[model samples]
Target: MTVVQVSAGWVPLAAALLLTVATAAAALDGVLAARAGGRPLGEGLLTPAAETARLFRQRRRTTVAADLPLQRIGGAGLLTAALLMVTVVPFGRWTVADLSVGVVWFNAMDVLLWAALWLAGWGPNSVHPLVAGHRFLAQALSYELPLMFALTTPAVAAGSLRLGDLVAAQSGLWFVVWMPVAFVVFCAGVLAFSAWGPFSAALGGGATGGVLAESAGVDRWLVTAGRYALLTAGAAFGATAFLGGGHGPLLPAWLWVLVKTALLLAVLVALRRRLPVVRPERLTVPAWLVVLPLVLVQLLVVSVVVVVRG
Candidate 1:
């Protein structure tokens, strides 16, 4: 690669590192905010931390009906999957491991969702946890297909799976301008994967926070940390794919990444308050049969535009 390409490559990795630090800060900030309000530090460790403390304080209830091993495996699996997804993400121009099949790698990593959620549900051997896990499984089936199809919209436009190439292609205009529908679809997928609002069926109120309901202490912390990391990854992907990556006229590449990522994260966090959770069953039918198909059509439209322009 040329010097510019090499320099560009570091953008994503740098963005990823910055995101890690920012998330740590945010988690810490959440803790501080809670403490200032007269809550325990552990309670303030962000929502995940508080949940962890709750789990740790509770009695370690065991039943002959539970698959203990599976529960442990599931929790660990979620963390692993999140980590794996981060590997292929381009922060700005740099990626830790950029491959021509970067997009495929992302899709492949998502397979861990099934194993992780199943383990969480089955291992707990409780009705609430099990029900939550099954709910997640059903929700996953609904959203994953559409998410993949949405991702393909950008790949089709760029004509490459390499995220770096995708970013580079946006020298003048970002993909979001041409593929607004796909961009919306991609955001929706991210929200669903993160179990964010409107798609948080796996984390419904009654089930003790769903799959992670029974987890305690460090286990809960890890799950929560992994989630922030996942969100950062998703934001980075969106920025890289659609928001011009690290390209900005006056600012440094890293700054551009930070700006874009923060914006995306803000939007995501804000949506928490704006959107209501949808039932898993409603999502399954409408998201797939209707929403996903529309995304595919959007992809086709984008492709036509690209072809015409070419």
Candidate 2:
């Protein structure tokens, strides 16, 4: 496969545009999900806009001894992490930074969420938010290793950390067909970190919005936007990594990429309505004992295949 280098300026601009689109799409998807579940249209869609306007006029809330700086970091960092992650994601053979270690680069961006969400939860100086932060941290422990192993399966199969090479290796067959477990685990990790679907304990209804219990005004808006952005970015990355990137028949590669990403995001949004939210505590044993081992086995299979093919 030949390397296609895009102009540095054009690539960053394109990535930024796509990231904006993805965030908007995610916001719309959330509204749609609520609508599908019989939520009022005004409440589902216009509510966020109205709330944002209201928040802009409202004063920021603070708790005694609250770490304002840390809270800002947590709220803003989520969007920043999502943007950085998307930079390395190729949309039909174009990426902002098609680094040689693109897979690892992707992993590094994902790991940033551990800090982002934690700060968001802990900085509020409140009990529910602190508990919410602890939940997400425990969640990281359970899912991170499996996620790493899941990522390794494709890297091993393609014999390259570069996403373009990984996509090229799927010209004949997509990795999702063979690495089904990895794809599933990867999606689970996506939902977990993004605080989406049934894995939304960090912002669950039980805790009166969990980590979001105390957030108000722009802080609330930023964190909420960041959550959806994370979901959108995760779905797009999952598409490139598992669903053949942009390779498809009849349509332009970029269109194909967009379609796959939209479908995945729909599935993710629909899942929240369809499935019961699983508490982080319940996820721990299964993630560590069951999912992690399955991910490792998938990695082993990929390794053996690569060796045999060579």
- lDDT of all predictions, in order shown? 0.71, 0.82
Segments of candidate 2 deviating more than 4 angstroms: 1-5, 15-20, 23-48, 205-207
Candidate 1 local accuracy as lDDT? 0.71
For residues 213-308, could you state the per-residue lDDT of candidate 1 as single tens digits? 676655555556555665666776788788988888888776787789778876775575556788888777888779988988997898898799
- Mark the 10 consecutive residues where model 2 has the least summed lDDT: 21-30
The digit string of per-residue lDDT tens for model 2 on 75-132 reads 8888888888877778786677778998898889889988888898999899989889
Q: CA lDDT of 180 in candidate 1?
A: 86
TM-score of each: 0.83, 0.92
